[model samples]
Target: MKTKLFFFIFSLFFFLKSNAQCAMCRAVLENEEGQSAAKGINDGIIYLMSIPYILVFGLGFFVYWKYFRKKKVEA
Candidate 1:
């Protein structure tokens, strides 16, 4: 478990930076003299993409905590 946790943390920090853009967006952004717009678009895309995964993970954690928590026995 410790190894897995360490690996997860290591992997998170060493992820490859992506310049993800659709073909049309890439074409438009590439023509600009400054690449800031392209970078911004890529960042926005990554941000939008991560939202659903975060929500699903949160819900799964809540469900696991609710269902698997220890119950108290009455005296």
Candidate 2:
């Protein structure tokens, strides 16, 4: 389990680069000189994309911790 978790986290850091722009956005940004806007748009897209996964992971962890934690049994 620890190895699986370690590999999962390690694999996350090596994601392939992706172009997240829509067709129209790409067309417009392609004409710009520096291409910084295109990079910014792609970055913003990646940021927005990761948010829901992070939130869901946090919520799931909270639920697991709350419900599955060992409880004390008083004599």
Candidate 3:
């Protein structure tokens, strides 16, 4: 249990910080005269990237509620 917990915690840190853009995207965005476009692209990338994580979290919560969290019977 300790090993699994430690591994999860250790792995979590690696994923916490990420540079999501590819080299071409970064280069093009950086060269743009207007900073708003660059900022918008970054925002869009982050928004699109978060959907998978959100979906997985929702699925995990659903599974826990359905199977692990049992309801009490009323007499």
Each model's backbone clash number: 0, 0, 0
lDDT order of candidates, top first = 2, 1, 3
Would you list the rank order by TM-score, best first? 2, 1, 3
Against the reference, the lDDT scores of all candidates come to: 0.79, 0.82, 0.77
- Candidate with best lDDT: 2
Candidate 3 residues 1-75, lDDT tens each? Answer: 999889977966765555667789999988889778877777778779878987998998898787654553321
Please report how far candidate 3 places residue 38 from its true position, in Å: 0.7
Best by TM-score: 2
For candidate 2, write residues 1-75 as lDDT tens digits.
999999977767754366678999999999999999899999999889889988998999998777666442321
TM-score result, candidate 3 = 0.65
Against the true structure, candidate 2 has what lDDT?
0.82
Clashing pairs in 1: none
Give candidate 3's total backbone clashes.
0
Residue 5 lDDT in candidate 3: 83
Whole-model lDDT, model 1: 0.79
